[model samples]
Target: MALLQLVLVLCAWWRPSAPAALPAHAINGTSPAASATVSDSRVRQERSVLTNYGGSVGLSPYFADLQGRPSPTPPTLTTELTPPPPKCMDEETCNPLARYRTISGRCNNLQSPHHGTPGQAMHTLLPQRYDSPAVFRMRAVGGGLLPNPRHVSLLMSLAPEGAKVEGNSLFVQMGQFIDHDFSITTTVREMTPGGKSVEVDCTACSSWYNPACAPIPVPLNDPYQPPHLPTGERRCLPMTRSVGYLVKDSQGRPVLSQPNFNTAFLDVSPVYGSNRCTAEDLRLHRDGMLESDENHLLTKRPADDFPLCFTEAGYCLHSGDKRVNENVGLTSIPHWSDERLYQEARRINIAQFQNFVYGEYVPLLLGYHTAAKMQLMPNHEGYFLGYDPTIDPGVYNEFSTAAFRMGHSQVPKYITFMNDKYEVTYHIPLHYAFFNNTMLALGNVFDPLVRGLLGVSMRPTDLKLVDSLGNKLFMEKGDPHSGRDLFALNVARGRDHGLAPYVEYLKMCGVKEEVSSFADLESLMRPESLALLARAYEDVRDIDLFSGGLAEVPLPGSLIGDRFWFESPAAGFTHAQLQSIRRVTLASVICGVLDQRNPRIPVHALQTPHPQSNPERRCSELLTVDLELWRETPHSPSPPCTHQGQSYQEGALVPVSPCLACVCQPGGKMRCQCDLSGCKQTQAAEDCYCRRICGYSTPHLKPQYRQ
Candidate 1:
């Protein structure tokens, strides 16, 4: 009955519910209830009635009698009645983190690949069935270790000169490019019987049995809805939640995973998936040297597997990836004329995408020595170093909700683009990146002036003084309201994700010294930063991972702080595979994009000699690819691959990121293990024994004691 009442409320969100035979409820203007009822002309009148009458509580006079009087505040809510869960005693009878503690990582997983199936699942890619959530001594809030906005804030304090220091925006773009994979979630929208839309606010829906996950008629709101679509009609923006597959897995299977998207490569699917459409449009000619402006796309040609963007037609034309499909706003940027704007950006963006992970980002973040052992570098590709069919490939709770979020600090306050003499240009606030198509059409960030600081060498936008434009995330057209408290949210999200506190990760990461109170962080972080953390949280154990990590300065050369670096290769990766990932740089990805002669794209701009020497060069000119090689050749497969009927792009150059490494068990059959440990046979290695020595333990987990 309670479940039915919940459904009834959800139904009311679309329209007022009536008996099955009523078909059209004056209460909700023709809602199908659970049925797929379409909206009709009555929607507008109904909305008007709703607007003029009672906010959400309003109903037409015709149904006022049917609507029950407000049930007086349902008695103090019985003090949450749900019993305080059993404590985390010896893993055998512990609860899932969400139930055991606060509402964190429990519901954070991507909506399962089986989304829209009989039941939508949102389980962890790396599920630790045994539970003992991280314990916190103080109630956690968003900005654990930073100065409270009540006193001093980072963005408000950033000076003009400090804000202007440029980093390799290429890596920044790459970070966003890859972020699309890890941070994807769709706004679930519900149609009003009157054709109006209501964003579903699922805060009231409990995580374990969230009615929000139910086909409940609640629409989820998103920041990118208004502009991504060519039609400009608001579309539900579901970021691609697909496990990234480079090629076939170690088991020779099509490396599949859950809550993921169709795109398995590192192409610019954020805007274009190399998907092109129409003949007489500029398709890369097969001669490895010209354009096929008039010919039809081949059935199994490279265009089929790695399609070019029909950016000339418009940004919305033929984006192959699903993300563009979600946010049509990404398509249709007015600047995409002569295809120069979108196409040129693509060339540089993709080169950087491959380059960042392959050439510098990975090695710097993971540490060169560690990366080499994991075989994450391009040179390790042939030795069976980086493929494991069993790896979850799902983003981690700590990584996603907290650790990786450190990038927020690096966001700049402004973005600059060039037109002429650097004279015909626009230097706009970075938040304008989210501005309307007209402003974005003016070429906001595709220039070469903003290229070095985003690399490893430049300082992270100090956590205390993060850029306002990028951090606020959602701003109304030109509104300057720095709305969302991102750091506070990151801190909150970690708790929501049920991630352990900084100390737990520290212990597991093999930090021999103790971090008992917030004061202990003083040695590793800015004293001011520690003071800020002390203000928000009462106990040191209460410090959230993201806040704590951000507050601490990174290792001598690493991009992320020590916790994220240690947590990055969690038990899921093999040593060789980790090596390969560590060795990965933007260069490897650039090299693999072609089967022909390469372009002079520098994998890392900072690494290239005297980048300041060519500050005036266009991003397109600095990074390059042989467009001619991408042209479809006469000798190319006429009908494409045997599986062309599937409509899924089958082959394209995908630089490997870390993936699972599975080996044949004693039975000589393949078995999938999601442990982040390298090879288990070698028991004495550092990562293998580090957890136990540090006092964290999981029975089945060999490498990390935190199973």
Candidate 2:
């Protein structure tokens, strides 16, 4: 009798309570009780389908397509499929005259309100080439199975040592920082009857039997990975397909397409957040400043917020992008004041960021010749009149998935920490810094890490990746076998997206006219690279876009190949604003957050420092954007001033000589000052102030005076 009573009590205690009902607003028009009834029935039906395939219902269509077999009958649902609700555009909320950009990126193009908004489909540069209508590309040109992604990675991605490049590590870091601002693909997640979403674990299922399982099986006697499992099974790297939905093409045929979780603009969405809700959460709601910790670093999230963090602090830094905590330099946040001042500061910061991307970053990545030839460089003077709303600014799938991934090759094996004299103090292996912030929380290592980035050169962009990335990426402590190969993952993701072959992109970019055989690429690729490609792929047309793109030689001085070079749209700014933005540089932006006492830095921070060509100088010597150009006139009536036979409102920049900039002051007066402050001066005339007969020749000279 006692044992029976104890068992009954334990069973009652362990019983879970029923899940709460969802609100009617969450399900559009359905009532709460009706939604619950329908949801319970739907869960049963979905679970039946999942059980039939051993928990891989999501991948059924893909396998059927690959095997040329009919798709399994889907379980009948109690409810009918309904179209999504129409998008509601609140004009008052998205004002055209508003100086700041919307958090959701809506109304960026007034003509097409949802052009660059999040959750929109990424633009396809060319037609997708899938093995079937809805399945991934799995067959070669001659109908044979394509080479395994792991085999391709092992043959092409390993290197004895990294080749050095002329650019500094900051160049690679900034590229990754900007790439996050462009596109982030969503992955599939299963929802339970309790309304909880969880990841679908494909690794526990049989390979290729479950539609969601696209595991890369390791070849026999692999160099890095274990040859076999303890149970005598083959080892496989797990990966899942990106979330996609079926859409009709021009011919009314269904095609698979992926959505970009991020807005397709370079608007610093990484710092500001992509959606209004996320943006609101990141703000302090006081003085228009972002929330930060006492140490001026990004604030830490709650203990239960990020379970992936494995540090003693038990939490990770919070930001619009999770990758922000990867490095210390990106974690620094700026303090702000009033609403107007905050808006003005954000505007100036974005303008300077855009200016740096075009004026310096793009030129170095694409080379000055290619950038100019493609008309991708910014104007030195006057306003940019090329703002066309008709051109969609959505990110291209080709660029995000394959071309921009070239940055992976530039990652060094280890991150170095240095002192004021550029001597190494200590270093950490690249894998140790992944998703771990223990080193950043200890003492004062931020400045030293930043100095190391500016002082050290990055590896050359090529086919080879470091051992840390190719063999031991994201490896946990004390576990040598708990790592994934990033190179293999990249190749697998390309096929999962059904992207076109490398030759197609080459033809689209006009890099090659005829690519019938591997011999045609002799001029563009080295002999060893060609041999490796031939060994991995059965045919020339079956090459993966990532593998082929990385194998080619970089264009003259550019870090990437011709296929990666594309023109970026210019932002809408006034003539005075453009002039001010043109003065901004990477060196100036880095200096803004550093300790004022030790503001010494390289003249060109993106390039490796040279004593004569690119020398170290005080931050004061760097040119920066003038925020006075963004000052707005008060609504109250104010007296106007005239300068150079033109009337201007208060706080407006007056048209004057190239070397002199005059601003309209209060009480109807004009204040004129020399724009070139740090230049060597020579008296040319009595009232003309300082003018040099030799002209401006310093590194800090204005963009217009660079020639």
Winning model by TM-score: 2
Which candidate achieves the best lDDT against the true structure?
A: 2
lDDT of 2 at 204: 32
lDDT against true structure, model 2 = 0.60
Give each model's whole-structure lDDT. 0.33, 0.60
Estimate, for each residue in 1-707, the C-alpha lDDT of model 1 and write its tens digit.
01011111111111111122222223224422231211334222322221121223221111111123331111111112111221221223223222111111111112222111111122332321111111111123332221222111222222222222224444454454466533443333445687654444332212212212211111211121121124432222111111221123344432211222212334333333211222112233321111311211111122222222211212221212111121122233333343333343343333334435555556655566666777664443222233333433344445655666766666544443323232223233433333122221222222223222222223354554333332344444443332334554454334333456676677777663677777666667766667656644456775556666776766554555100111122112223323433443444333322223333334454332235532333233432332322222235422322222332111211111112323221212222333333334344243433333423354344444333
Q: TM-score for every candidate vs. truth? A: 0.46, 0.74
lDDT of 2 by residue, 85-126 (tens): 223323344555344566667877767877787877777888
Off by over 4 Å in 1: 1-167, 186-190, 193-198, 201-356, 364-370, 380-385, 418-426, 440-461, 465-472, 477-482, 512-514, 561-603, 606-707
In model 1, how large is the Cα lDDT of residue 220? 16
